[model samples]
Target: MSILVYAEHDNKNLKTETNKTVTAALKIGGDVHVLVAGTNCQSVAEQAAKITGVNKVLVADNAAYEHQLAENVSALVLEIAADYDTIMATALTTGKNFMPRVAALLDVAQISDIIDVESADTFVRPIYAGNAIATVKSLDTKKVLTVRATAFDAAGSDNSAEIVTLSNVTDAGISSHVKDELTVSARPDLGAASIVISGGRGMQNGDNFKLLDGIADKLGAAIGASRAAVDAGFVPNDMQVGQTGKIVAPDLYIAVGISGAIQHLAGMKDSKVIVAINKDPEAPIFQVADYGLEADLFDALPELEAKL
Candidate 1:
């Protein structure tokens, strides 16, 4: 069986998630090929060709694919869908947006956020806000999968695969490029950080997040927030970590003043080590924390920052 992985890049650099997704594809036992779709993204294609298990790299350099609009990318994937048995992408914003369109167009089941591959057809995915693991067998001849990158090790760069350019392009004029309001931060990307420090409603206000800034800078950690913090306007929605937000598996996760709602646990439960700091000893976060400290954050933050 041949597998096609959708390369995730920013035209210049390949995202680590793509390498992790490739690892998932390799585990499915196939000749792995990566599809790099973007305008002026030849650099990304070249980088993908070096991934350890990739057999070939397909490049579709066109303006329509530059922004990776779901309408256009889905159509492009469908054009070559017959060449591969499985099509996979990282379970990120981009993949979550377009993979369903491809599945719907092909009239097949789209397995979402698969954490494990039991076989070529049977996969293990989280369900019910990650409260359960569901093993599903897809009856469709063609499998379209969105892999959770945090579950797999990234594929190393060890080989030089042949690169093939494609002329087939799709442009759905229904959408157009618009302005992007991005939060520019010097800190590490939240999903890829080795250490993450997060706050919750207990933070009270946005200015108080500075308490984490000193600690984050000391450890070179990324800052995250619970859905409560976001809802309470203590931080932007992008900084939220929960079932409805970003998924992370950092080596060390620190929860500050979080009550440990199940939705919040679903996002960072995979962290190698978890530390919870809350005034209430009975907070559910202590249940999953490797280290639990009962203290007032106002007092603890300064002490921790000084100690670090």
Candidate 2:
């Protein structure tokens, strides 16, 4: 089987999730070809060509793909969809936006957020807020899937693959690129951080998030927030981590003043070492935490910061 994995990028550097998705594609047993679709993204294609298991790098460089709008990118993918047995991308905001349209256009089932590839046709995915695992077998001739990056190790960069530039481009004028308002942070990205420290509604207010700042700086960790904290206006939505938010599987996840709701757990439950600090003993977060600390965050924060 041959697989076409979408390479996620920002025109300059390749996203870490692309490497992880490539690893998943390799696991499915195929000649992995990465599709780098963006304007002035030759550098991104070069980076993808270095991935360990990639067989080829396909570049679709055009202004229509600059912002990677779902309408344009999906149309581009469909133009060459007939050659690949399986098409997949990381379960990121961009992938989620376009892959469904590709599936609908192809008239096939789109498997979402697959954590494991039992086979080329069968897969394992999380369901019901990650409370259950569903094993599904697709009967479609062309398989469309979204891989959960955290579940697999990233593919290394050691080999140079053949780079093929495609001239067949699609410009869907239905949607146009608008300005992007991004959150600039000095800390590591939440999804790729080795260690993460998150706050929740228990933080009381946005100013209290400073308590985690010292700890995050000391450990060089990324800061995240539960949906509650974002909803309460303690932080921006970008900092939120949960079922409806970004999924992270850091080596160490410290949850301060956060009650573990199922939605929140679905995001970070896969962390290697989970530490939960909450005054309430029955907060569901403690159930999944490898280390549970029952204490007032007001007192705990200061002491922990000093100790760090």
Best by lDDT: 2
- Model 1: per-residue Cα lDDT at residue 106: 89
For residues 1-308, could you state the per-residue lDDT of candidate 2 as single tens digits? Answer: 89999998999999989999998898889899999999999999999999999999999999999999999999999999998999999999999999999999999999999999999999999999899999999999999999999999999999899999999788978999779999999999999999999999999999999999999999999999999999999999999999999999999999998999999999999999999999999999999999999999999998999998
The runs of at least 3 residues in candidate 2 whose Cα sits more than 4 Å from the true structure, single-residue gaps closed, are: none
Q: Report the Cα lDDT for candidate 1.
A: 0.95
Which portions of model 1 miss their true places by more than 4 Å? Answer: none
Q: How close is candidate 2 to the true structure, as a TM-score?
A: 0.98
Model 1 Cα lDDT, one tens digit per residue, 31-129: 999999999999999899999999999999999999899999999999999999999999988899999999999899999999999999999999998
